[model samples]
Target: MEFLELPKRTSGNRTYGLTSIIDLGTPTEDLKNILNDYHHIIDTAKIGFGSACVTPNLKKKIDLYKEYHIKPYCGGTLFEKCYYQKKIPEYLTSLRDLGIECIEISNGTLNIPMQERLNIISQIKKDFHVIAEVGSKDSNQEMPISEWKDEMKLLLEAGCDYVITEGRDSGTAGIYEKDGNIRSNLISELIKDIDSKKIIFEAPTPKHQMYFIKEIGANVNLGNVKLTDVLVLEAQRRGLRSETFYLEDRECKLPL
Candidate 1:
C-alpha cells in the first residue's frame, strides 16, 4: 500500500528498494547511532569490502544491525577471500551464522572465470538474497559494454536478485567518468540492454545520484553509498528538496 504513490518503488523488507549504505571501518557505536537517527531511511548495510573481517566488534554488533531491520551483508571482497581460500561454504556459513542473509558476489578485485562466477551465483542464491557485480575495481579494467551486457544476462539467468553495474565507490568505472558523472550514451546503451529494475548502479556522489535519477527515474538501485550520505540520498529519492525537484519535472511530474 505504501508503494501506491510509486508502484515502481517497493517499500522496506523488499529485495529491491531504497539506498544501500556501506560501513567502511566504522565503529559499532557509530553504526548504532545511524540506526537510531535514520532507521527508517536506511536499508542494507555492507560491512564494507571485507573490512568487516578486520573489525573487532563486527560480530557483536551484527545483531544490533539486524535488530533495526536493516539487512547486513558481507562485501564481495570478503567473499573473494573465502573463494580463494577454498572455503566458500564456511564463508557463507559464517555470514549466515552472524545473522546476515544478503550477499554480493563480485570479481572486482580478483579474476574469476565466467563458469566459476556462475557457480558462485548459483550456490549463493540458494540462501542469501544475492546481488552480483559485473566489473573490475581497477580503473584501467574496462569491461566492454557489450561484454557487460552479456555478463548481466548470465547473472540474471543464474538467479541473482540484483545486478550491480560495477560503478566502484568513486563512480569512475563503467558508465561513470572520472569526475563522478555518468556517460550519457553509455548509460543509454546499458539501460537498453539490462532491465533497470533488477540492476543497482553504484552512485557514491550526489552528482552521480542526480544524473542517475534524471536519466533513469527514481527507482534506480544505487549502491556503495557512504554511511553519512544516507539521508541525503533519501531526500533526493523523494524529491523533498531542490536538488531533486527538477527530477520530478524530468519525469514529467508536476511540482509537489
Candidate 2:
C-alpha cells in the first residue's frame, strides 16, 4: 500500500521537533498499548503535576516508557512542591531511584527567585537532562516579553536542555488568553530572539496544537499534549488533517 505524499517531518530520536505527551494518569497497561503504536512519534512523556508520586506501578510505567525510547519524567509542579518543602535532595533521589533520566525544573506556581532557579538548573544539569520552564501559571501574573526572553536566555545558559513556555494543561494561562487564544505578540517576540528549536510550547488542545504546527512549522516542540492526541498531533504535523492539509515541507501550498 502506497502512502500519499505530504509534508515531511523530523524523525528518529528528535531534539528540535519534539512531541511531549502529558500523562495525567493513564494506566500502565493502557500506556503500554498506546506506546506500542505511537511510541515512534512520542519523544517524551511528562507525568503531569504531582501524579508521579501517587501513580500506581510508577516504576514499571517509567521503565516501560524507557523501553519504548520515550524519556519519562515528572512534571515541574512536583519539583516546585519539593522545593517549597525544602526537600530538593529527596526529590532528586526519588527520581534516580525510579530510573528517570530527565527532570523539569520550573517556578510556574512558586516564587523561586530567578538567580535561585538558575543556580538549581546549573547544579542539576550535571545529573540529569534538565528542562526548565518559564512563565507563571496564574493568568493574572502576566510577564513582559523582555523578562520572558531574559529568563529563557539565562535558563539555556545555565544548562537547560529546553525551556518550556507555560500554557498549563488547560491552555488558559501563561502563553494563552483566558478563552484559550494564543498571545501572538508574545510568540513573535519570543522567536525573534530565542531559538525556536530550544523552546517547548505547551499546546494541550487541538486548536492550540494546530496553531503551533501551522505557525512554527511541523517541527515545533509541543508539550502537555494528552496521550490520546499523539497520533492526531502527528497527523497535523504531517499535514494529513484538514487544519494542516496545505502544508508542504513546512510552507503553505494553498490552491491558486
Candidate 3:
C-alpha cells in the first residue's frame, strides 16, 4: 500500500527544511547503520563537542558520512578549544585533511571578541562552509534580543553560510530556558528581524522540534538533533506523528 505523501519540502541541498544531527562519537559501525537507514533525511552531521578529537578511526567515519552524501563537520566547542589554544590554523588544516568541508564557529564557551569572530568567519568562509552560532551556552548569561539580531546579521555578512541559534545539547541553554522550554518571545523578536530560513534552531528534544514545526512551519531548519531522532523529526515535519497529525487535515491552518 502507498503511504500518504508529506507536505512539500525543499530538497536536501536547499537552504530550508534542513535537519542537522549530532554524531556524539557513535561507533563507526552504528553510525554506518544509521546513515544507511536515514541518510535521505539527514542533511548534516555534527561531530558534537570535542568528541572528534578523541574518536578513533575518525577519518574513516568522516569518509563514511561523505560517501552517504551527508555533510559532516566538527561541533563549535571544538572550534572554541582550537581558537583559545591558538591552534586555529592547525585545526583548519587537520579538518581539511579529514575531508571536512563544513565548520561551525561558535563562541558559546569562549568569550571571543566580536571583531575576531567575524574575522574568523571571513577567513574560514574562503576554505569551508561556515555555520556561525549566536548566543551564550551559559544559562546565567542572557543577551538582549537586539544584540542577538545584530550578531546574526554580522555573522551572515561576515560570510557564514547559515547562522545557528544556540541551544545546547540538552536544549536547556542558549535560546532555551533551564527547564528546556523555549523563550518564545525572544525567538519571535529575533526572527522578526532575521530570515528564518537562514537560522538553524538547535532543538534536541522531541517537544522542542514539534514546537518549531508548529510555530515556524514545516520547513524550519533544525539542528543538534540526536542521531536516532532524525527520522522521527521528519515524521513530525510531515504530520505523520500524533503530535503534529493535525497538520494533515485539509481544514487546519497553522498559526501566523
Best by TM-score: 2
Judged by lDDT against the true structure, how good is candidate 1? 0.77
- Summed over model 2, clashes come to 0
Residue 30 in candidate 3, Cα distance off native in Å: 1.0
Model 3, range 143-184, lDDT digits (tens) per residue? 998899999999998888899999999998889999888999
Candidate 2 lDDT over residue span 103-162, tens digit each: 999999998999998888778888999999999999988999999999999999889999
Report the lDDT tens digits of candidate 1 across residue range 34-125: 78998777777878787877888788777877899887888888888888889988887888788788888988888989899898777668
In model 3, the clashing pairs are: none
Candidates 1 and 2 compared: the better one by TM-score is 2
In candidate 1, how many Å is residue 43 off? 1.4
Clashes in each model (backbone N, CA, C under 3 Å)?
Answer: 0, 0, 0
Off by over 4 Å in 2: 1-3, 250-256
lDDT of 2 at 97: 96
After superposition on all C-alphas, the RMSD of every candidate to the true structure, in Å, is 3.7, 2.8, 2.4
Rate residue 188 of model 3 by lDDT. 87
lDDT for residue 99 in candidate 3, whole number 0-100: 93
In model 1, which residue pairs have backbone atoms overlapping below 3 Å? none
Q: Rank by lDDT, highest first.
A: 2, 3, 1
The models' CA-based lDDT, in order, is 0.77, 0.91, 0.88
